[model samples]
Target: MIGRRILLAAGVLFGAAAFAQAQIDNGLPGPQPLDAGSMILNRTLFEGIMDRNSKVRSASAKPMPAGGYLSYRASSKVRQKVTREYLARAEKAYGKPIAEGLRKTLGAIDFVATWRRLATRDGLRTGDLGDSVTAYWAVNWLVANGKENSAPGQMQALRRQLGPLMASNPGVRRMSEAARQEVAESLMLDTVVLAIGADTAVQKNDPAVLAKLRTTTNDRFKQAFGIDLTTVTLTNRGLAKR
Candidate 1:
């Protein structure tokens, strides 16, 4: 009985020592690294860091799909190449030191749509460029032959792009009227080109989509610029609207 009692005592001591050693070796840290700043900083810095990180992620993220095209990301190099091309073409087209609002308008073409078009039809290799110029050259084209209310979506898309400058833009709220009008005027040139330049072989290949694209652009142009494109006559001993 004494021997058994001694064995029990020894076992208890052994377990107690083992547990103590484990407690020393396997103890969790009471204060984590992030916890050091969490008290006074309250994580806002961390949250902002996360938010900024997300933007970095998003700049190259796979974009949403549009039309019948597969979506892809044009690499930084390709985007930079296109930007250089755009700047060069734009400089040739509209002289040096491009106006801020006009540059903004041109640069805001749907990247997702642009990338998709490049990938699908333009033969853009992975992370390489197709015709980057065409991406922003005209995002959604408007058929000149269509009715006034025909191309609502195209106009809407243009209007949406135009909005940032229109009162910062019109959809958001009213801001500087003069500045807004100035920006709108700058955007109008693109509108005019689209009105005259929308007929394409690809567009004709898909007639139904082309039709919707037509109607959508018509109403949207009117809605966007308050200018009925169908009625623009280029007056002054002017050209006739054929």
Candidate 2:
């Protein structure tokens, strides 16, 4: 369903900007890359994009569409402003030191383009952008770091979490099967982001950020899909290979 949201959202962003190829940073020479650290330390990733999108669309003479992720909406003025505000929020979300490090990393990155890729054609063909990419990064770090054993999961997690909601909301039936599946899967992606974000926060010695992340994440989840993740059991899952 996330893809449908993205596709529908794309109506406003078509012919907007270059879609970036997201990759795990290899410390190699390139335009910019998002490795594990960037993903972890910069937890307000989506918020920043949304802020830019809202700012840009509001600035546009003609009405700009707003259904999905389109942070790369062109607006020279708002780019840096969003970045600055985002960093301030980041400092609040992750502390000053880590935020400073993120700033150094951001220096070389064109985040607008990168954010657009997450919800556009540049997103990998195999899966929707938010879930696939977020899960990959979140799980990659967890599994690679041997935290799979400790990785958190939502009880009736993403997929399971949506079951009741879908049955009640007949409007969801209008969506294609692929879209529904993607939407369900996308919920798990949010869990992964929260899990990884919490883990990162703990490691950074600011364990408090986890609660805030969870609250905000649930709010966003509800706003996006009209389901409340707060009621779900958030524990661990048997994450075996599919």
Over 123-216, each residue of candidate 1 has an lDDT whose tens digit, in order, gives 2222211122112213322243343222212222222222222212123143233322222222222232232223331223666544554555
Candidate 2 clashes between residue pairs 3 or more apart in a chain or in different chains = 1-179, 1-182, 1-183, 155-233
Q: Tell me the whole-model lDDT of each prediction, alpha carbons only.
A: 0.29, 0.32
Per-prediction TM-score:
0.23, 0.30
Worst 10 residues of 1 by lDDT: 1-10
- Mind sharing the TM-score for model 1? 0.23
- Give model 2's TM-score versus the native structure: 0.30
lDDT of 2 by residue, 1-242 (tens): 11111121232222111110000111111111112222112324333433443344222133122113311223444345445654565466545764565465445445433333332332222223233333333332232232322222321122222222333333543444444333323333233223334344444454344344444444443443333433322222211111
RMSD of each candidate? Answer: 30.9, 17.4
On lDDT, the leading prediction is 2
